[model samples]
Target: MGKEHVIHTDGACRNNGRDNPQGAIGVHSERGSISERLPASMERHTNNMAEHAAINRGLKSAPYDNNPVVIKTDSELCQKTFGGGWAQQWERNGGRTAGGSKPANYDFVQDTMKEVNYRRSQGQDVRFEHVRGHAGDSGNQRAHDLAQQGLGQGAPQYKYGGRY
Candidate 1:
């Protein structure tokens, strides 16, 4: 993890359908290309899920163990989800029925949280950083592009790993 291991990850869902969902991670060793498209986990747009998927996949693909991870995402919800702390205020007060809370969606967020917690327990040095996506962040932009492509058809090919 010598030259700033930057992991840029993102997920995409088209029209609330994950039929062809995708999550791409760009692992940059000092800003040079090392982009890889990770397999998707359920779809349907939720800025939080996309952001979480990216961070999870990106960190999981780091080259060195226990290395620092810098997750660049555009979703604030994604940031709060992984950065630790409380869930949405409404959810915290058992108001899953209000303020964007839907009975069908909370499950995925909960499941993702479990996975994220497991990863943390495994001694992974993870940190979530926000980047204004689509603002020309190369890795982030590439990830989003790949995700949209994945949403179309044929699972995206990994530019770095995942074939093994």
Candidate 2:
């Protein structure tokens, strides 16, 4: 088996749900890292949305190769929504929850599914693992710090450029 390529992603939303809420994504990989704030006019600036964007962008920008891609995140929702096969079931169920309710964050979930499937079809193994937030793990810490930058809390510690 080839070596794994690890991608640690995180999102932060300052004043979420309030007017002028801000969000951002932080991506850390062996190649490099990225810290990006959400667009100025985003309709929703929730933490979950920011998390979804980080994971999606990480997958989208990951290098296409034989190595497996492990996406480390603190959001269990993202892990369960995609990795738990709920997304697949939701698609088959016409995007309804088991209770017949419209699923939340449908767009982000759908977009993530597309990116994951496309990567799989390209021979990349993608996996999502939930990491505890604020843990001292180096990668997770770096990602969290970058996320803070996304929220305009501080400057990014690393230059942003790489395989993502």
Candidate 3:
């Protein structure tokens, strides 16, 4: 087992659920970093959606060959939904909540699960950890700043491995 990549991700939404709402995702790693505002088609209008998108983007940016990838995020919702058993139970229950209601952010959760499963299929050890937001951690701070800046930025760009 070699050095695993530690990716710190964050998301932000301006005026969520209001007119002209905007959301963005930020990802940071030792290889490089990405700070991109999500697209309209993604229809991400909430903070949690932005957070999930960041995770999805981070997972996609990382190569399947990179084993033991650790994703650190400030959103506990992400940790609970993906890393916790809630997502598994949801899948078992046909995407329904324990109360038999359609869960919120189903699309985001599904997309993230696909990424997680894909990494596992490639023999990668993927894990998620929750970090306190704005707690002075350098990686978390970078990601947080980028996510906030993305609220008014142009299309997002990825700089992973100096490729894209």
Candidate 4:
């Protein structure tokens, strides 16, 4: 196996839960960083949607080799959805929650799960870790900053770094 890679992801929403809320997602890793506002095409603009989008983007951006990838996120909802079998149960029920309704952020959840299953199918070890937000973790802080930046940007930003 190759060296493990760690990625930090975050989401932010200005005016969250109100009309005209704006959402963004941030992802940071040794390879690069991404900061982008959620596409306007999405019907809902909420913090949870942004969080799910961040995880999906992180999974899509991860390397597709045998190396392990660890994604750190502050959102317990994201952690639980991916790691606590919520996603599996939702999938088993045809993407409906136990309440017989589609889960919130269904599109993002499906996208994230698709990426995870694809990576695992190819022998990649993917994991998600829950990290306390705003606790001075540099990676998390950086990702948070990137998400904030997305809230101000004209276009999505992608910055690359030398591979580790």
* Model 2 CA deviation exceeding 4 Å by range: 153-164
How do the predictions measure up, each by TM-score?
Answer: 0.59, 0.88, 0.89, 0.92
- Candidate 1 pairs with clashing backbones: none
lDDT of 2 by residue, 30-60 (tens): 9898898887666678889888888887877
Residue pairs clashing in model 3 are 36-156, 158-164
* lDDT for each residue of candidate 4 in 71-136, tens digit (9 for 90 to 100): 999999999999788999999999999999999988778767877887899899889999999998
* TM-score quality measure for candidate 2: 0.88
Order by lDDT, highest first: 4, 2, 3, 1
lDDT value for candidate 3? 0.81
| Candidate with the larger lDDT of 1 and 4 | 4
Local distance difference test scores for all models:
0.54, 0.82, 0.81, 0.84
Candidate 4 regions exceeding 4 Å error are 157-164
Instruction: Report the C-alpha lDDT of model 3 over 1-164, residue by residue, as the tens digit.
Output: 77898899998899898887788888898878888887776653788878887887787777667568889999999998888878889999999999999878787778778778877887888899999998888999998888887877665643222212
Model 3 alpha-carbon drift over 4 Å, by segment: 157-164
Error of 1 at 32 (Å): 9.0
Window of ten residues with lowest summed lDDT in model 3: 155-164
